[model samples]
Target: MSVTGPAKPNFAASGRRVFDIEIEALRAVVARIDGDFSRACTLLLATRGRVVCVGMGKSGHVARKIAATFASTGTPAFFVHPGEAAHGDLGMITDADTVLALSNSGETDELLMLLPVLARQGNVLVAMTGRPDSTLAREAAVHLDVSVPAEACPLDLAPTSSTTAALAMGDALAVALLEARGFTAEDFARSHPAGSLGRRLLLHIRDVMHGGDSVPTVPADATLGEALVEMSRKRLGMTAVVDGERHLLGLFTDGDLRRTLDDDGIDVRATPIATLMTKTPRTISEDALAIEAAQLMEAHKINALVVVDGKRRVVGALNIHDLLRARVV
Candidate 1:
């Protein structure tokens, strides 16, 4: 007798099948979008208070993510568990709030139970459900149809397709409201002050550059030796060659020093810095973002930049290390 074992399951094919089902479900939901989406966005945008998103189980998870997206994108919103809302959590909601409820079956008992109270309180109820004729949909102020042809689950019983549709619909609403409100990246940076994008957008060159006397600079008539002394004293890897009026005349960097050293005809102690300094060196405004400075450095394949004003006067200096220290790189 030959020993036999169960065959290996085709996991990749099964996963692909699930993706196909959910993708088709999204397509169906997209086709169903009409004025109701606009209505939902209007209602959300006009809401005087926060958006209170409520659901149960997997729908609740999606609702929480939706709430976070809304809050981060400029809309005031939060998630409230329907079961908890029936308890003292209902106190969190007020008449000014807009209630967004999610239920795949449109018959979640916990969600339905809160409708009467929300209705009595005169709250605007937006229902996202698969069943259009369900009680929740019938009672809502606006109905968002998220019905799918079938669930990705083999038994067609799981919330896979329905939850995906609900999540996408929630994202659609949040983004629409964000655009209508003209939310800007700076505003987003405020909400994410600790994020990389916040550092990139909120941090200006003035904040990180060595300004005033800390900037390494040598008068245009100074010798290469004088510029080298300034570069060493400031430890900025470069020195700005400026005129008597403090106007930037040129720049002498470590690279320039190396090239000068290679030419035996030039002497650091005797050569005028202006003769070897790079005229029209790349410069940046103090108001530019630190990320812009990083980009400027990367684009030019240079390590340091001299900050200058409209008159081409050097105001500050910064190197890649400064950007690295500020976490702006």
Candidate 2:
């Protein structure tokens, strides 16, 4: 038997309809946020223990994401399935902990069953539900209304808009808490040490720049040919021209070499690098961020930079390729 679905639906139009419904739902939910939101934040902040998030089914998925957001944004939190909590996982909740429960209908049996236990244990309960009059909301120390205008699902039976509302509310709470705690980007990087953002913010020029004998250097008095040999030996596309004490006097690059070749009168073997090198080259401190080095290159339209200390002595060198290798570009 051939089963024919409804005449070919317009997929793009269907997607747009869903977006329209969800955006309206979010607006409705946003208008309802008032002092209750502030109260929820204050209660969570005052907790001496972790925030334990609990929910069932679709709400459970949202709860898990909410828990992750809270944990990553300076609040210690984790999700516990309401069903599993019945099988002894409830032990994870202590009197000092705050419980964040989610239920679209506020009548999920598993969550309702645990309310008595949570109450008797003296744990503060914060409930997120579509119905303010539901038992879960009634019993909660604070209730967050996440009701939506309707589901984005065509049948209006699936958990679409309601879940979106819950997730948005969860994000709002997490960010508000993040700001209240005075959390910094450095603190965020510490928690996300392996991510690209951490690499950009935590990595310094000294950590990525070529140092020691690997750096291409030539005395200011060295012949242009000698500087070219040093540039080739180090493969940095450029060489730092230094004085007797290794103080950076100038820089000579492939551009300078091309100009020297064009002049015909300048001899690579006879001309001192100091006369042909750039007298005022851009330099950066080794203590600067690798990202800052990238910006400096982009701003000045240069390829390489000499790393110097407070005394302007050459310590290291790095170029755009080095930033790319360090994944800072």
For model 2, the run of ten residues with the poorest summed lDDT: 189-198
Error of 2 at 273 (Å): 0.8
Give a tens-digit lDDT track for model 1, residues 1-329: 99889999999999999999999999999998899988988999999999999989999999999999999999999999999888899999999999999998899999989988988999999999999999999998899999999999999877899999999999999889889999999999999989999999999999999998999999988998898999999999999998888899899999988988999788779889989999989999999999999999999999999999988889999999999999998
Task: Provide the TM-score for each candidate, comma-separated.
Answer: 0.93, 0.93
lDDT of each: 0.94, 0.94
Candidate 2 is scored at a TM of 0.93
**Candidate 1 TM-score over all chains jointly:** 0.93
- Clash list (residue pairs), candidate 1: none
Worst 10 residues of 1 by lDDT: 259-268
Residue 296's lDDT within candidate 2 is: 92
